[model samples]
Target: MLDLARERQGGVSDYRIAQLLGLKPNQISMYRHTAVKPSNPVAIRLAELCDLDPATVVAWVNIERATTPEDRLAWEIILKRLAPQKRLKQAA
Candidate 1:
């Protein structure tokens, strides 16, 4: 389970996970913390990176994919707020 992965990885930052999966950091955080689940493609990537079962990831992904755009946007805002300060250090 992703919750377990979050725990096992010593509270791995969602941004790092996003980087590994080539997604926006906010998207990773949304998948991790919010009720909105990840998409199948995202689940597959997460399973591959986290050494988790694809089925489990698929279930979560299905739920996340079903979320409304408005809900996802809310999660995006929440995830941004929850992000660490260091993540803003990029030389953009």
Candidate 2:
């Protein structure tokens, strides 16, 4: 999901994607982390916005929905830790 988000080149920030899809920014954030799936309507909107296949988007959402909360939290922590390193590399 982050891959797709990055591919957008900020075309789909959490707030903007949420607003366009009638979801909350937090929901978009969760989607990025695979913490939760969007609603069917929101999934369709996300596919359109991200230029992804709707079926692929739906599959991703379903996979996210199946993840345990603890795993999601752990993954988020790892991402947070790596984020600065990624930025540093980009800056270099």
- Give all TM-scores, in the order shown: 0.50, 0.50
> Candidate 1 on 1-92: residue-level lDDT in tens?
55555665678776667776788988766765787766678778778777765654565455355458776665555545534432564333
Q: Which residue pairs collide, candidate 1?
A: 37-64
- lDDT tens per residue, model 2, 7-36: 574655567656767877777677667656
Instruction: Give candidate 1's error at residue 87 in angstroms.
Output: 41
For model 2, give the 10-residue run with minimal summed lDDT.
1-10
The runs of at least 3 residues in candidate 2 whose Cα sits more than 4 Å from the true structure, single-residue gaps closed, are: 2-12, 63-92
After superposition on all C-alphas, the RMSD of every candidate to the true structure, in Å, is 13.9, 10.2
Off by over 4 Å in 1: 1-3, 6-11, 63-92
